[model samples]
Target: MTERVEVRQNVLKENDRIAGELRRGLAERATLCLNLISSPGAGKTSILEGTLEALGGTPLRVAVLTGDIQTERDADRLKRYGFPALQITTGGTCHLDASMVQRAMASLPSPDLDLLLVENVGNLVCPASYDLGEDAKVVVLSVTEGDDKPLKYPGIFRRARLMLLHKIDLLPHTRFSRDAAVADARRVNPEIEVLETSCVSEPGLGAFVRWIEQRLAEKRQAGRPARD
Candidate 1:
C-alpha cells in the first residue's frame, strides 16, 4: 500500500512540476496547445489531418508536433497539407513526457504560430498520467473499436475535456453502436464534451470545428491567447 501511494504521489507531483515549467515556457510565445490521446489506430492522426484541412483558411496559424515510436512517417504525411509540422520520435516510449515537449518547443517554429497540436504516442493508458501542459486534452475513439472503449479506458476518458468518435461513416457496414458508445463515455465522464465525426462522410465536422473556434474564443475571453 505504501509503495503504491508513493508512486501515485510522485507521479502527480512530478507531472505538475514539469507541467508548470512547460506552462511558463509556452507563455513566452502564447501558443495554444492541444494534446491528442487515444489507442493505436484510433484516428488521432487522421483527425489532425482533417483539422488542418478544416482550418486551412481560418485565422488560426496552426502547426503540429506528432509523436511516434518508430518512424517520422506521420509528420511526413502531414506535409502535403501545406502546414509546418514536426515529428517527435519517442524511440519506443508509449507516451510523451513534459521534457520531450519542452525540448521540441525550441526547435519548432514559433512567434508565427497561434496553435500547436501535439499528437501524443498512441496509448489510452499511460498518456493520461502525464501532463504536457496543454490547454485541453482531446481523447479520440472510433466506432469500429467497439462501444465499451470508454469503460475499458476510464482514466483517459475521464481526463479528456473533449471526446471524439471517429469513423462513423463506416458504421452502417459494421456492428458499431453510436448511441451506446456515447452513453458509455458519458458514464465515465458526464461532463466531457463529445463530438462525432467521419472524415469520409464529413458529418458533424462543422460542429467539431465550431467547438474548436468556441474554445479558442473562450481562451481569448479568459485572456490566455485564443489559439488553442
Candidate 2:
C-alpha cells in the first residue's frame, strides 16, 4: 500500500510540474487555453462546436484539440468548422495528461491561434486530477446527466473557473432543476461562473461567445509573442 501511494504521489507531482511548464508556454504565446472537462454525453463537444460556429466572424482566432480514448471522430467533427484542430487519442486513459496535450500541441497547426480549447476526454473524475497547462478550466455538466453532478464531483467543480450547463433545452422534458443545480455548484465553488447553453436552440450561446472573446481580448492585451 505504501509503495502504491508513493508511485501515485510521484506521478501527480510530475504531472503538476509538466503542467506548470505548459502554462508558461501558453502565457508566452499569449493564447487563452481552456481545459474543458465533463462526463460522457455532457455535450462538451457540441457546445464548443456551436461556439466555433457562432464566433465565425468574431475577433479571435480559435483552435481546438480534442482528446478521446480511441477514435478520431470528435476531432473529425470539429474539422468541418474550418479552424486548426488536432486529435489526441489516449488509448484507455480516462483523462488527458500534460504529456498528451504537449504532443497534440506539437501536431496541430496552432501557432497563431488566439484561443486554444483543450477538450479533455469525457470523464469528470480522472480529468480533474490532471492539468494540461491551460489559462482556465471549464467544467461542463449537462442537465440530462443530473442536477447533483456539481455536488457529486466536487473536485472538478471546485477547480473550474466556469461550469457550462449544457442541454438546458431539455429541462422541460427532464427532471433537472436549474436553480438547484446552480445553487449546488455555487455552494462548492463560490466564484464559479455558470452559463446555460443549448446547441440547437442557441439560447445562451451569446454569453458563452462573449466569455471566450473576453478571454481572448485579455490575451491580446498581454502583447506577448508566440513561443516557437
Candidate 3:
C-alpha cells in the first residue's frame, strides 16, 4: 500500500508540472479555460451545443476540446456551430490529464482565443483528481441523476467553481429535489455557484452564456498590465 501510494503521488506531481505549464500559457494568452465534468447523459454536450450556438454571433473567440472513451460524436455535434472543436479520444481512460490537453492544444486552428472549453470525459471521480490547467472546473448535474450526487461525489463538487443543474424541463416528472441538491452542493462547497439549466426549454441558457462572457472579460482584464 505504501509503494502504490508513492507511485500515485509521483504521477500526480508530473501531471501538476505539466498543468502548471499549460496554465501559464493560457494566462499569457488571456484565455478563460473551463474544464467541464459530469456523469454520462448529464447534458454536458447538450449544454456546450447551446453555449456555442449562443456565442456564435459574439466577437469573443471560442474553441472546444471534448474528450470521450471512443467516438468523436461530441466534437462533431459542437463543430456545426462554426467554432473550432476537437475530440480527444482517451481510449479506455476514465479521465483526461494535462498531457493529453497539452497535445490537443497544439492542433487548434488558432493559438489566440478568448475562451477554451474542455469537455472532460463523463466521470466525476477520476476527472476531479487530474488538473488540466483550467481557470475553473464546472460540473454538470442532471435532474434525472438524483439529488444525492453532490453528497456521493463530494470531491468534484468541492473542487468545482460552478454547477449547472441541467435538464430542468423534466423536473416536473423526475423525483429530483432542486433545493436539496443545492443544499448538498453548498454543504460540500460553500462557494460553488449553481445554475438551473435546460437545453430543451432553454431556461438558464442565457445566464450560462453570460457567465462565460463575464469570466472571459475578467480574465482579459487581469492579464492586462497595471498602469503606473
Candidate 4:
C-alpha cells in the first residue's frame, strides 16, 4: 500500500510539472484556456453551443477540446460552429490530464486562437484533481441535479473559479433551489463566482460570454510587452 501511494504521488508530481509548462506556453501565446468540468447530463455542450452562437462573427477566435470515454459526439457538435474542435477519447480514463491537453493543443486548426476551451470528461471527482493548465476552471451544474451537489463534490467546487448553474429554464419543473445551491457552494468556496444560465431562454448567457471575452482580453494584455 505504501508503494502504491508513493507511485501515485510521483505520477501527480510529473503531471503538475507538465501542467506548469503548458500554462507558461499558453500565456506566452496570449491564449485564454478554460477547463470545463461537470457531471454527466449537466448541459456543458449545450452551454458551449449557446456561447458559440453569441460569439458569432466576433474577432476572437475560439477552439474546443472535448473529452469523452467512448464517443466523439461532443466535439462533433461543437464543430458545427465553424471552429477547431478536437475529441479526446480517454478510452476508460475518468479524467483528462495535462499531457492529454498538451497533445490536443497541436491538433487545433491554429495555434493563434484567442481562446481554447477544454471540456473535460464528465466526472467531477477525478477531473478536479487533474490540472489542464487552464486560466480558469469552470464547474457546470444543472438545476435538474440536486442543490447539495456542491457539498457532495466540494473538491471540484473549491478548485473551480466559477460555477455555472445550467438549465435554469427547467427550474420551474425541478425542485432545485438556487439560493441553497449558491450558499452550499460558498460554504466550500466563498470566492466562487456563480452564474445562472439557461440554453433555452439564455437568461445569463450574455454575462457568461462577456466573462470569457474579459478573460481573453486580460490574457492578451498580460502577454504583451511593456512599452518604454
- Candidate that scores best on TM-score: 3
Each prediction's whole-model lDDT (CA): 0.83, 0.86, 0.95, 0.90
**Candidate with the greatest lDDT versus the true structure:** 3
Summarize candidate 4's per-residue lDDT along 1-228 as a digit string, tens digits.
355443335558878998999999888889899999999889888888888877778977889899999998998899899888899999999999999998998877778878888999999899999988899999999998889999999999999999999888888898999999999999999999998888888485877898898888888889999999
For residues 1-228, what per-residue lDDT tens digits would candidate 2 score against the true structure?
Answer: 355443335558878898888888888778899999999988888887887888777666788999999999998999988887788998999999998887778877657667899999999899988978898899988888989888899999999999888888888889999899899999999999998888888486777888888888887777656587
Error of 3 at 1 (Å): 21
Lowest lDDT 10-mer window, candidate 4?
1-10
Which pairs of residues collide in model 3?
Answer: none
Quote the positional error of residue 215 for candidate 1 in Å: 0.8
Candidate 3 per-residue C-alpha lDDT over 1-228 given as tens digits, one digit per residue, 9 for 90 to 100? 355443335558989999999999999999999999999989999999999989999888899999999999999999999999999999999999999999999999998999999999999899999999999999999999999999999999999999999999899999999999999999999999998899989595987888988898899899999999
lDDT value for model 2: 0.86
Off by over 4 Å in 3: 1-11, 202-204
By lDDT: ranked, best first: 3, 4, 2, 1
What are the per-residue Cα lDDT tens digits for candidate 1 across 1-228?
355443335647876788888776555556667899988998888888888888998778888889999898999988778788888998989999888887777786664566778999999999998999888899988888888889899999988999888887878877888788888888988998888887778684677778888877665566555585
TM-score for candidate 2, please give it: 0.90
Cα-based TM-score, every candidate = 0.89, 0.90, 0.95, 0.93
Worst 10 residues of 2 by lDDT: 1-10
Candidate 1 — worst ten consecutive residues by lDDT sum?
1-10
